[model samples]
Target: MNAGTTAERVYDSLKRTLANGSFAPGARLEPARLAQELSSSATPIRDALNRLAGERLIEMRPSDGFHIPRLNEIGLRDLYRWNEVLARTALRMSRKSEPTGGHHIAPIDAADLFGFIAASSGSGEIVSQVASANARLAYVRHVESSIIEDTADEIGDIATAFWQRSISTRMLIQQYHKSRLAIVPTIIELIFQDTQTIR
Candidate 1:
């Protein structure tokens, strides 16, 4: 394959592996092993690792190797808060800019969100899937990070519950148009503080 294609393949494979929890936090990412597993070459693997490192998904240690960056509880909370803001903004933009030629623009459902993410198999699909998956993965990463930090057990379940409730609240806001946008950040802060306290 071409260099670009190979790089894309490497990037996608690594992203999927990271997303699915295959590469745990602080796990070393050996370039040779990655190239072998992905059936690519070191060049493409290096390119992919660089890209991931740029995104803070992985870190390049001095005199060491690439490892998944570990997030503390505060970092996890900040990540989740960012995700919530971005997801809400994306949803609002999607709703406002939907095509008008009798094209139905439905609010994103949980199943649709999950399926869109599951079907993402390449870098091309990343932009389309990132909003949802980032929102979801933020929670997952928060829980896992919390566990590693010894801040909490069963934090993933709490994050999942918060996400479900947020989805419902979004639906209600769309249907009723009664909720203020200011409430979103408040809700996020409340949930974050509550989770921290519960831990």
Candidate 2:
């Protein structure tokens, strides 16, 4: 393949890896070494790193290269809060006019559910952004999930309620916040984990 194709391929691969926390929080990513790992040249590695950094999956420092960012709990909470609002708003606005057959039930996982809800906004950009965020938080979510009470069923139930018209949008949003708030301790532990801290 051409250099450009190689770079694009490398970018996709690295985006997945970085999002899945393969590099770990605060890990240093050297372009040359990463290029070697991917069997590509440093140019493509640098290109990929820059792209991931743009999505906030990795941090790029001038002259210091790429590093995995330490999770900012406060920032993350704010992001989650707003993302919920957007997704909830989008869901509320669309459920009335959109086709009901397709959205009969929510996805089993939180990320997919959020993506599905965002898709209701009729914006491909929202779906793509959610997918990227999903990748970055997949590992952390997995860890956090293991220690916390699983509420997948509750989320599904909420979706069902919405689908059946048994609940209002306001109620759905409130339950979403409640389900998330229930896992506070697990998230707190995750944020302070030694591996998650910026070195």
Clash counts per candidate, in order, are: 0, 0
lDDT of 2 by residue, 29-121 (tens): 888888888999888888888888888888987887788776566655665666666666666655454334554655777676677666666
Off by over 4 Å in 2: 95-106, 162-170, 178-188, 194-199
lDDT of 1 by residue, 41-113 (tens): 8999998988888777789999998987754445545554554444444443443222223343332333233
List where candidate 1 sits over 4 angstroms from the true fold: 96-168, 171-199
Q: Rate the local accuracy (lDDT) of all candidates.
A: 0.52, 0.69
What C-alpha lDDT does candidate 2 achieve relative to the native structure?
0.69
Candidate 1 residue 75 Cα shift, in angstroms, is 0.6
